[model samples]
Target: MCLFTETRIKFRLFEGCAAESGTDGEVVLGVEAGTYQVFALPDHGSAYGAQWVGLTGGTGSQDLARNVVVAAGEQKDIHKIFMDRKGTVTGVVTGADGAPVTGGTVAAVTPVIGDAGRGRVAIDTQGRYTIDFLGPYAWPLSFQTSTHAFQWSGAAHRRQSATLVPVTAGQTTTFDQQLALGTLVKVTATGSPSGRYAVAYNNSNGDVAGFIWVQQAGGQAIFRVMGGQQVKLQFAGGEPGQGWYGGTDFDSAKTVSIPATGEKVVVYPYS
Candidate 1:
């Protein structure tokens, strides 16, 4: 991700009134005793980021305005915040034997901030892929392919140990990874409304390995997963607070063993 600094600041304060920063990038606004959303436009002006403020405090996030509260006759001071910039990543995928991996999708996965930094790109026949509009952050990137195999730059197998890659604003970073031969499992689901269904897997310690999302065709959906390891499946979509193997909620989602044979696993939702 990138960072952009602008001299002028514009804000949509507390419901209706709008304010602009002076030459020194400062603004004073009189607001009522209620929460308000603060939105600003960057240099590009295509995207807007927002933060929320209130008489008591404020909260913020990427590409979103935060909430703020104000009390009666109270004064508040706001600080200058940095805006997120964009970056691009280009790469290629290959198999364990250095052969091109075809017909699979590649994703730049980051363990930080939960899946917020994850971006995906399709692998072309020649195994080339690109993930763009990424935020500038140095973190561990795990390259996950369609078969749930992880790889690192200049490695031949799944990346158990990886290093942090730095991405700068408005710059392109090249990262190529090789996939290892892993067990395969054919997963299908049943007894749910027709829509896109996902089967997510996590390790024993509850860390996400990968997830397979497929549109359900005729009450059945077919997807593939790397097998020979213990994985837990959390069914997303169709219904809520139900369909877990041994529990009643999505948080307590079920766990199953994908045998070394890489056999098929069918989920019977609400069954």
Candidate 2:
């Protein structure tokens, strides 16, 4: 068997606002030698690795929790920076009636803070989905379907309660979720300001769904979600007004619901 695959690995070295790319797993730069953040992206469907600058050649633990220092005329051997094979995560999204949720989207979100190692896959007609390039460990995942509301791996509306799925390298970890459709509410908001307004569903703790609606001209910002669900309206790019429903902080944004079929909320942002 071949020892290495043909997948291309990319390396990104970051030093504050400056960045450099190395396709051969090692990068060289002509700048001041200081500490830098090391980020690795591989095409073999693996999670992106982020750590401190630690380039070693011997069979010892590479120190990645600190910065890397490069000196003049010193050649750093980063050939050991290789991407490992990605693990697999497979699962099914079902409804409260024990029926399969077809055409749903399953996302394997890593708890790594940034958008690294997060993978999304579409549920097949049989409500089955497989996400690759994952680490061999528990992954906090979420699902969204047309007939069901957003639910985490723990069957809860909150993402913090989502259970971590244990994935295996070169193997598949099977998991499933049962969801229920919540009350659908029509949401609309209008405000006056030089900034844009964004709307999303919040459960008094964290965001539940990843959907958002943005309105920039103080016009209609429309969407639908669970009724009476705590949603947040975020304002950006402008200051708030001094009138009613106007403030300089996040509390100035309006939280509304579809109490009626065609009702809308008029918020004053820059009045």
Candidate 3:
């Protein structure tokens, strides 16, 4: 006889416009009176895949076409969301020196479906990780470690150029990766408002590399990326005049180059 550890699966309720996480398999949401389609997502690392409410199987967000009508001061109960088992991906993570790398994570993203079908898991002491549940499709995997810059599969730095791993239902696929050293970039924001602020970095391919929140005024955030990569930064919330770091939009935004020894930059008021 063999015993396997059980993974706890959490649920999330989505209505195409807003989404909220559920506790203990139940969710209560407050929305304006309207007609909407509901979608349910199992938390990452679960053995079950996401699906639309009222349907047992749905491949994408577009399949969430069933509508639930809501009126003023009305309360409704959506039927139980049926979860289906999805594909699994298991792999080992090693450093450039060819040794097992511990204390990191592996993540999966289905670009076509966006965040609706994403999953992640932590690497164990043996440098092994498993994304127990993911939609059956081609997905790009991201390997992240403290000592290395996060890299997509095939050692590509950006998602657009990374290799896509194919997955099948009720099956497990193996992928191994060796991380490369990355440059740590620190960003400090001054003259920020008293609330939280979002800072994100994007590549020319329009792919977001990473993001962190600045909790207070003059707070700092940090991320790692491959050296020589040109990326743009975006700041959101906290003040009236906040947008792209250097320009009004992505196309016109100024780019910063990451160096081998790392770099530091400051975001001033209105910039």
Candidate 4:
């Protein structure tokens, strides 16, 4: 009997004020390559869009393949895909007790000549680890934890049998992030702004989440209230003017929560 592994990620390619395409990524099934459907879903946020296809030419035995897409966010359910990958990797550093090692930093040394992407992922508590990595063939990788250091200065190979595989065209590889162990401050927000619109929850750092904008259509705002036990966060503010606007008050704004773990919040005000 033959065995294989598969993984997936929710990826999307956004267009300006238009329908966006979403992907299910690559799906790895242990079947002799012949032909399969690579599903690529493009959502108008109102209806179904299109589908993509890929061909796997397997001559039997363990092999690798590559698929290509014209657009982004399209999931490919195919019989064959990347038999080889050109990118970096991510992993966790644990103690002898099988515990996650915290405060670790992984570094990338792969040069563009070798086709290398910036490989970096923060290990969360519970020894969780992940990496935003890439490697065309095999690339050297270096890692450092709070107390220990490790190196896989070898070729970073892409898994052939992954459910979520990268396309030859637009690729974004996600390595499962697992850290040895440490205090994690996962932040979440709603109405966080990006571009000219206000998107909630711009939790980049523990400091600022993100920003928003007000148009002539209507004024918008966010709200956040405070509590005693492990303060839950929320945002509230006002945009009375038209065109573009912002805020400059704590009352126009509210207090937020500090997380013991990751958090989620949403608050906005309008005129």
The deviation in Å at residue 30 for candidate 4 is 49
The candidate with the higher lDDT, 3 or 4, is 3
* Model 4 lDDT tens row, 1-271: 1112211221111222122223544333333333322323222221221222224332111123223322344443435332222233445556535666655444332111111222244556655554332323222233434432122222111112112323221243444322222122222223333223432221211111222233323333332211111222222233433211123332233344433233334333332
- Best first by TM-score, ranked: 3, 2, 1, 4
Please state the error at residue 179 of candidate 3 in Å.
Answer: 1.3
lDDT of 2 at 255: 53
Please report, as a residue range, the 10-residue window in candidate 2 with the lowest summed lDDT.
Answer: 1-10
Compared with the true structure, what per-residue lDDT tens digits does model 3 show for residues 72-125?
Answer: 999977666556677878889898798999777686532211232234578899
Q: How large is the C-alpha RMSD of every model relative to the true structure?
A: 10.3, 9.9, 8.8, 17.3
How large an RMSD does model 1 have? 10.3
Q: By summed lDDT, which 10 consecutive residues of candidate 1 come out lowest?
A: 4-13
TM-score for each candidate, following the candidate numbering: 0.50, 0.53, 0.58, 0.23
Where is model 1 more than 4 Å wrong at Cα? 1-80, 83-88, 103-118, 142-163, 168-172, 186-198, 203-222, 226-230, 257-269
In model 1, state the lDDT of residue 120: 42
Off by over 4 Å in 4: 1-90, 110-119, 153-271
**Candidate 2 per-residue C-alpha lDDT over 150-267 given as tens digits, one digit per residue, 9 for 90 to 100:** 6668765554456767766578778877775654433333444433434343535435342433534555444434443455544333444332233444355455442323333445
Query: What tens digits encode model 1's per-residue C-alpha lDDT throughout 35-82?
Result: 555544222232322223222322222213344557799885555555
Indicate whether candidate 1 or candidate 3 has the larger lDDT.
Answer: 3
For residue 67, give model 2's deviation from the true position in Å: 13
Model 3 shows how many backbone clashes? 0
Highest TM-score, which number?
3
